[model samples]
Target chain A: MTLLESRSRTSRSSHGGTAEDSRPGDLCLVVMETPNAPHSEAQAAVSDPPADLSHRLSVLLESIGRGDQAAFAEFYQLTSRRVFGMARRVLIDPELSEDTTQEVFLQVWQNASKFDPKAGSPLSWLMTISHRRAVDRVRSSQSSTDREAKYGASTQDIDHDSVADQVGSRLEAEAVVRCLETLTETQQESVRLAYYGGLTYREVAERLNAAVPTIKSRIRDGLIRLKTCLGVS
Target chain B: MTETNSGRNGRSGSFGDTVAVDLASGRAVDLAELYALDALTDEERQAIEQYMSAAPAAERTEFFDRVRQARETLARTFRIEEQPPADLFDRIVAQLPVQGSGPDAGTPAPPASGHIAGGQFAPRQPASGQPAGAQPAGGDELAQARQRREERRRPGGTRRWLAGVAAAAAIALGGVGVGSYVADQNDPMNQVVRAGDLREASVDVAGGGTATLLISSSEDAAVVKMNGVPAPPAGKVYQMWLIPKDGSAPVSQGLMDEEALSKPAVVEGISSAAALGITVEPAGGSQSPTLPTVAAAPLGA
Candidate 1:
């Protein structure tokens, strides 16, 4: 898969159909029937998101918390691509990811008021929901025995380096890549196996032919290094 | 042999031994990182969540932030795979329970008092009253507000949250409609099923089973619970309709939840609904009830 950095700084008038053009009730008729049709005919009805995206997203979410349908639509437009992208990676199936994406947005609409800025960034909050839903879809559709059988065979010849190299080149920030590069190769491998491959540590250990305890420490220690390097605080 | 082998190289002896140490540490900082990376086993993940339930809000938020930060940084490594299908956004908005339409319609303002008794874990009352997973409600305005503030903080299925909200609604509205008499407080459907104001009737379905129609004392709401209702054939669903006494077209309340097949669903906003009707419609449900009504329970009967 090709890697493309997300550097959207301004809201472009790309997606069409303005909020004023259609009331929610009339638009809902189209939605309930077609279900898969594009809901927003226009771009999200907001000025360009300021350089500080977290504040803008939080502002939009606050409006959504008050039952503002237009703002909810806008929030979906801003975040749905990344949300869908995460679901796609986790599930590795377009159809399942689509359904999962739909479920995540629905939850967001119903529970937007529940978002606490103090907890984390809006993207993280949103992606957390997306990842959970995607993982759920993945687990529910495939049995554990099937997953283990598949992973055991496929992961043996998997070239994880190629995956990371492709991802690293397109990352928006060189600093993130630089921080990741600081880890020892084994540390990098273990972290990549768990994070991108969506494998548990036990599964990761099995793939790497390492002890579980060794894998655990490698992952934890590597993360600490990355956190310090990235200045996460 | 399996236990001994795994224990020989496992992180802290056996899995059980590891859990003891993990919990004794008093925080799941390591586990949260693993969780964000999708690295924890199912058992380890659940244990961490339970541990998180007991942690302080600041700690929980910090843990969540760390996890999210890791995820965001890691995410920069990949690209968008594909756009979601069209009109998906509209369907999402349409499904949200219409805001400002219920009893709390005019009360969109924040609560007046800022008091809620804070607690480490927000209680979740499961459907069955067995108290198997039910936690005590963190009573007080501050706790309640905090609970509302972070409703999406944890990841219990939203269906459970919906049931809890429905029960809370039943409790709050129960006092307003019936001043003197009280509905059974245990039933989540009590708001629409007070004893004094109840108008009940039952009809036997052609295929078998029974549909019970219950109107609240104020006649503004209803609850329809079905028992042993045969599942609709493939590609079809069992739908419920609220037929008005004023000659309006039957209104659909969407498909009935399978779990609620036995548990009654509170059907609100039914001021002049004359009768309840059940039908078999296409999978997503029809705009109106179709064909011979499988069963009908007249409100006046």
Candidate 2:
């Protein structure tokens, strides 16, 4: 089983508070809470107000820039899963994704001073770094063969259902799913394939059998629509 | 929109042909969405960057603001949080420079001190007369070329490598002379370092310092450079082995003493090696890697 599956299972069992010691109502409570409980402390933090979370991350980054290990650790705890999940989504190989995630955090620690809060939100900065690193790993020569095999094995549409299954519990993620539903089929596919598949616009166009300009405009239009729906400006 | 396009066209015509058309058609502004989505290739991104660089400061700020918002919105869609493996943080910690020993510790060093030329280890030359963090002649150009090449090979890899080297140099060199000691073209280490597909990884030694392994897949060789690493125990020496990916026997690369450790050790025939492992061995070396390696840097093949 995946580490996430094992973790959720452990969390479920722990929430049970000893099966033999629990009453039926307690069991029912555990059952009801299972789907709602944040998977970890980090996930719990995700429910914080977006502005507060972003501010906290920016503060942590400034501390980390001064070589604060504790701040670095806290930052890692708050952001690692998102970083790793993005890497895993793009790279598909857990080992490589893990390596990329490690590299991303190391970069965070070393170059936290480069984080310009004026340019973007802390989460956006972090995810930008994460996404670029993951895409680079996928495009690197070392993984080319693996990528070829992956491409051969799976040319189908992105499994949004599976993506939703993984992220469905989070409020922001649910809103994102709702917003994604507002996109046209082509726009959604183009954006998803380019962003998550780590495919370039040209590659996305090729994958969908569309023109490059069409794919580019679709991705751009789709993101614009998402920006509107998500109220990000 | 037409007025905006005509004004942009007057300025963008001098930038370049593709960029001129992109701006004239008002697609350059729309390309911000593609840029934010990372759907554009390097060339396309550069085109957009050129267009933005030519625009008025206020316009440029507005464009980037839009891009940032778009990226932020898209980033929120990736909410599937899977906990990274428990040991990953520890691994990152191990690579971090010790507190107060990093480049930011009250030193006004060049920001570029983080970058080390490929295969060019910081040669410990106290008498070389180059001050710590001094930029060599044409260093900026070389660094930019290296950065571009690195981005072409693997985006974001150069930054991470720079970070590693910065941390490693800070700890291993004690924050002194972190500038690249560029060797002449005739140097064998230079040849491998200059390879198009050069890659590197560094690991902390058991006692102190760091050992960096620079791998060139195109050259089928790797150069192992040791900095501030203590010599092996009396009657013992450090030996290198190529640990095969197939789970076969470790192949001996060579041995290094105090003097040899100061220089780069070029290990050829690393195409099949999963990692370069170093172990403490009797002076001449051992047939196989001794249990518990002193240091090992994965080739990431």
Candidate 3:
């Protein structure tokens, strides 16, 4: 489905399409395929970026930590819309989302130096912060039900093809979805519990009644399968 | 970290240690690297960090590759589009106080001085200088000029020429020494009589809450009127230290309390400190600080 349709659905659920309809921007879709979309695997045949996107983010963060305002602006220009979207997804109010955006940026300014590339990807770092901040806001404002409803609805359309279609066009998330499909039913379920459900590996293991090591290995194997199947560099 | 040469594998009965020989489909797969990249629980992450940190030297290469590949895929999987808010950098810099201020504030270059609080800075004898007297006039003179310029800038160039004059004087008298270095060395008004060595110190509280330390040396042991830190709490005072950063234990200079000296209290051993620190300690200062948050006034910062 297009981003427009998703926003329309979100609009139906809460703010009634007001914010969605008002924006004159391109409804800018990165437009990769959804995991369930037709012809999902075909997008993987075309290779695009040679390096992982995290490295680029790491460099941007390093310059930002050095107090480079121009770099900070550029980082924001590229990242703000997505962050705003995620914030809006979790926090229904535009004003609150904007406030979260401001706080997220302030955090970025304060903690940029802590972004060590060795630990993990910039996306994870940013997402973790965004999610935590969003969660904090939800809890603080006593708006858990409203926030979760919007979150649950928007994420309902999680297709294997969409990641490919949205973030990058070249080699879609087809391989990841396909590799994920190849896992044993239990392993696949475990991977899902950990990934989409945001459960830790230990929690995944506990829920599956499997040993922690098994859960760990299963998730890792699942990802490796996705990496190889997707032909991701 | 203190675990055995090899981890005492506790998974004997654990699922990981089970011997399930897949005879029918005899293919073994290793997934340690893959699991780490997936953001496992803290325990799992700790296990991996231990395994990787202590992995046999030979296995490191393969391990790193798997880790890197996993990180790449995951990095690509999620992306963040967040940016810093406006003018944050300016605010961060603004929060940082200026390097020099307070009583011991005029010396050029940073020298060994008893550590004082409230970011009071001591001037070091310029690499080339006539000691005890270097035209103290230039020191505060330049400071006042700087303030005037700053004041002028405050109104957004309201007093443009005055600010300009101050700026010009600052440029002329900075460490670059546009004027004669020796010209003011002999002037008594410019020289602080080396009181030899400070005997003791006391925190002298002032009207505006700024606490000054009166440090008296022996006869003529450079009496340094270290000032500027506002008086700390009564129950908890700012304890002084002649902190040596050479990795050695600290030496106590003195504590700043209300009952201390009202004027510049003399302190012995005031000139050998590599760095000075003020920590909030018990009423009667402790051997070590209870809270030593160095409000660092960097030497020459």
Task: Give the number of the best model, judged by DockQ.
Answer: 2
**Clashes found in each candidate (C-alpha, N, C closer than 3 A):** 18, 0, 42
| lDDT for each residue of candidate 1 in A139-202, tens digit (9 for 90 to 100) | 7787545555544454462321221222212232355568778888888888866654567777
lDDT of each: 0.52, 0.60, 0.41
Worst 10 residues of 2 chain A by lDDT: A18-27
Residues B1-301, candidate 1: write the lDDT tens digits.
1213232223343222253365665435555566777677677788778877888898787677777667655544333333344334534544567663343321211111111112212232322321111222312232233234334442332222221321211112222121123334444355454333444433455464555455663747766656456677777777888888899999986575343354456666666777777888887889988888776655532
Report the C-alpha displacement of residue B186, candidate 2, in angstroms: 58
List TM-scores for all candidates, in order: 0.47, 0.50, 0.37
Per-candidate DockQ vs. reference: 0.13, 0.17, 0.07
lDDT of 2 by residue, B15-36 (tens): 2224345666655666677777
After superposition on all C-alphas, the RMSD of every candidate to the true structure, in Å, is 20.0, 18.5, 24.2
The digit string of per-residue lDDT tens for model 3 on B1-301 reads: 1112121233222124211221112111233433433434344445555665666665555566666566555544443222122222223323322223343221111212222233322222223331121223344353344334444443422122111211111111222111122323342211222122212211212222222222332332212233334456668765656555465776775665643422233233544444345567777788975543322111100
DockQ: which is higher, 1 or 3? 1
Label model 1 with its docking quality class: incorrect
Docking class of 3: incorrect
